[model samples]
Every structure is written in C-alpha cells, then in structure tokens.
Target: MNEVLVSEKLVVRVPCAVIEYNGKVLAGQRSAALSFPLKWEFPGGKAEKNESDEDALYREIKEELDVDIEIIQKLPVTSKDQGWREIILVPFICRLKTLQITLTEHEQILWLGPEELSSLDWTEADLNVIENYYEYLSVKK
Candidate 1:
C-alpha cells in the first residue's frame, strides 16, 4: 500500500475529487501504470503540504484534467483504509467552464449521466459519493 510520511508521523494523503456536472458527471479511467488500473474515478489528487483544500482542488484538476473548475460546493469527507493509514477524501461539486478536457494521467474519460454512473464499475472509494450523486440527480429529475 502507498504510504506518505509526514514529520515522523505517517499521514495518508487527503485527496479531493470534483464532480463536474453539465447534465452529466466526469469520470476518468486510471492509466495501466496506476494501481487501480482502468477503474473509473473523479478527477483530483493529493492535497499538497500547506495548501488549502480549494487550492489543492484547482491544482489537481489542472494537473490531471487540464481544465479550470469553479467549485460549486464541497461534499462530505470519506475515509478508507489503504492497508496503511486511512486516507481521507473530500469530494467537491464543480462546474467546468470549458467542456474540453485533456487527460494527462488517465487512459480514457467518460461523461456519464446519473444512471450511467450508477451502472459503472467505480473505484471503491468513489462508490458512496457516486450513489449519493445518483440519488441527488434522481431527486432533481
């Protein structure tokens, strides 16, 4: 399992994922080189040391998706064990001004509607939020 060492205390990373919706949510397929190869996940990454959540979100999206995002709202944080320390993930709902996304780290990307999202084989960490978002969409419709 991947572990991050912080100041003599091993601290797992806090990754923030963004749900970018324009009638659909964006999901990225992990590259073959990555641990969760081919599994779909929301676009984001680890929060840098001393960086704020919003800044980390922006930096991650720009690095991974190559697009700027406007954070709509932050969702609840979730924790999962990665065989090491527990990883805390914070998900955000965001709006993408440009639909054009250039994937730098992922193999493929999909823009999925709520129903489609529920049917997909998502990463374990993303499953709960995916279900929540699907429910939210069902209610909205």
Candidate 2:
C-alpha cells in the first residue's frame, strides 16, 4: 500500500503550475517514492506559512523542473480528502519562460494537449484542475 503522509494540520495548501507552452500544458509523473506513486500531476508543492501561491509555484517549478514560469492567471481551486489529510490545490495558468527543463523530483514529464490531458492517470485533485482549466480556456475563446 502507498503510504500517505498524514498531516496534523486541518488543511494543507498546495500550489500547482499549469505551465503552457506552444498550446500545451506541462504535466509531471510523481516519482515512485512519493505518496501518489507514478500518478501524473502539475509540478508544484505545499505552500509554506506566509507564502503566496504564486511564490510557492515559482519556487516549486524552479526546484522541481529547474525552469522559470510566468503566471498568467489563477485557475479554480480544487480540494480533496486523502482520508488522512485534506489538501487544497491552488492551480495557476503559467507560461514557460525557458525551454530547458531538468527534472529533479518527477519520474518523467510530458507536454500534453487539451485533448490529451485526460488520457493520463492523474491525481484526483489534478483531474479537477484539468477540468477547471479546460473550462477557463473555453471561456477565453
């Protein structure tokens, strides 16, 4: 069984990046050592106390992918319960500022199109993020 890191806190805040480049969104596969082993998700991590979601996203993308991103807009927030902890995912639509990516945390990464996003085995919160993002895109058009 996958070990879930139960948090003593009431709610955990996670900021995620929905990095877009050339009409594709970046998705990362969680490392096998992580809680959601091999599940696909946007690259980001838990927000520290007093840190904004945008700041956390910038820090996380740099730490995980070794690339800089420009936040374009904020997507709808998604929440999920792992039975051990509650997580609120703050997703942002971002533009990739650099081309070179060095993966430090994820097992692998992929640039997926709108139609392709739902084809992967994504985390539950990410599924919500994807849905919300697609709706956001549709409204923008």
Choose the strongest candidate by lDDT.
2
State candidate 1's TM-score. 0.83
> Which residue runs of candidate 2 sit more than 4 Å off their true CA positions?
1-9
Error of 1 at 80 (Å): 0.9
Task: Report lDDT (CA) for all predictions.
Answer: 0.77, 0.93
The residue ranges of model 1 lying beyond 4 angstroms of the native Cα positions read: 1-10, 135-141
What's the C-alpha lDDT at position 101 in model 2? 99
Least well predicted 10-residue stretch by lDDT in candidate 2 = 3-12
User: Per-residue lDDT of 1-141 in model 2, one digit per residue for the tens?
Assistant: 899986585799999999899889889999999999999999999998999999999999999999999999999899999776889999999998998999999999999898899999999999999999989989999
Clashes of 2: 0
Error of 2 at 30 (Å): 0.3
Question: Please, what is the TM-score per model?
Answer: 0.83, 0.92
